[model samples]
Target: MDWDKLRIFHAVADAGSLTHAGDVLHLSQSAVSRQIRALEESLETTLFHRHARGLILTEQGELLFDATQAMSKRLDAASARIRDTEEEVFGNLRVTTTIGFGSIWLAPRLRKLYANYPDLSIDLMLEERVLDLPMREADIAIRMKEPSQADLVRKRLMDIRMQLFASPAYIEANGMPRRMKDMTQHRLICQAQGATQVSAGAMLVRELMTYAVERTLTVNNYFGVLQSVVSDLGIGVLPDYLQQDFPQLVRVLPEVESNEVPVFLAFPEELRGSRRVQAFRDFVVEEVVAYRRARQIAAQ
Candidate 1:
């Protein structure tokens, strides 16, 4: 019932040590211990089991900790909403995307975003896992396919296809594979069969495997596959967008490519009015437009 005591309890429960919690809350260890004792007295429950090594949360403590953790996330969400009301765009923006796209594409282009909003702090979480946007796991996400999560503001960013490519050095040494059947002579570098990736990429890799290439290398992510290709190890199945950045990578088997994989950018509908979200969404749209224009010009 007492907010201050509950706050102290949450901190102690989180840190598992009174001294550590005191260090965080700027309170003396004895004072923190006193507050925790008072909270337990008020609630008539033993929240933590004290041991020589450290404190372990009791069942009640675990339940209370869960509630406190939710409260913290809600508080963070409220703070973000409050900050968004300001005219100036600033504060932390958590963006989640696949590692290959985040590291190879979006990360390189983020210089322009930071240049425009110098105060904006971006936490770029790169993984295949789709973070819960509505629950505030991340502020925004750029995913390979449309997000199935409800109450999301989704936009199709662009479409990408998985294509075969090799370094100039590798092609020079092993010669180019002009047809899908010719792949047997070259080593294939690709994402592992059971790895987490878009369906289109997996299909492409499967097709490539049917060629029975003499040697092969499998990585868990496209970034690793790209690294091996660029290192002149072998031909790799990679996204077409990479061609713009790594111009030296020679496209292999021009007629062989995967079906288009739709790229989508999404955020919680509640974040529709968030200035930071809008700024980032607009920036990504602009980048996608510019990328398309660049590709068109190069074709000409």
Candidate 2:
């Protein structure tokens, strides 16, 4: 149970190659191999199975690796907490959200946040999968639905609805859909039916597909769908929030819309006092409020 040897073993097990682990640890491959051998001798067990391709963890090695992984995450959480001081918000903050919202909405508005806290570093993870917050997969998450995990500090940010949109050029060429049935005359762009998306968005796409549009383009993520629409490809089903950023996009078939999808912001309860988390939370709340106000003003 030498801590140094355990560290080397973790690095090798994680990388699956002594040379790669050596590169990361700044040690020679022979040196790393010596440490692993010492650790195995101390424990009287084999840690890895060697092969031409690389190393694979033995059953005992898997158990030890699991323990080391937990230890590493705990150390990271502690380091983050220590780095976060009350007087300054200077540290890395991992924020996870769907690709569409992160790319189209949040990324554009992040400059304001950076202006306020110039020292803050943000790692924005954009994907469809929900990362585990409690285990430190990500520090904070902005999800379409309320997080169901235990020991989470959650806040409802806003609700968004899926609606149809098309560029003015596309609408002019293809003609606007005066009614739902008019969709048959134009091409449709949307997230593929089996793609991972919020239930509300999928429902809207399904309802639109029922019209039997002749030409269709289906992308896996909303960013792609928005790009296609912006390119004058076809009418697309997209979140209503996009209107503020994409003024050129005309809302098509104003009467058609989807049920609201509630957006939530959440973090581990243990990070309740983290200044970095607080700053990000406050920044996001302000952005959402400003966006809402902008939409209201546009309506007037």
Q: Which stretches of candidate 2 lie over 4 Å from their true place?
A: none
Candidate 1 TM-score over all chains jointly: 0.92
lDDT of 2 by residue, 1-300 (tens): 799998999999999999999999999999999999999999999999999999999999999999998888888888998888879999799999999999999999999999999999999999999899988999999999999997999999999999999999998897888999899888889998899999998998888888887789999999999999999999999999999999989999898999999999999988898999999999999999999999999999
| Residue 261 lDDT (model 2) | 97
* Model 1 poorest 10 in a row by lDDT: 69-78
Worst 10 residues of 2 by lDDT: 205-214
Where is model 1 more than 4 Å wrong at Cα? Answer: 49-53
User: Each candidate's TM vs. the true structure?
Assistant: 0.92, 0.97
Clashes of 2: 0
**Candidate achieving the largest lDDT:** 2
Candidate 1 per-residue C-alpha lDDT over 161-260 given as tens digits, one digit per residue, 9 for 90 to 100: 9999999999899998778888888899998889999999999888888878768999988899999999999999999999899999998988889999
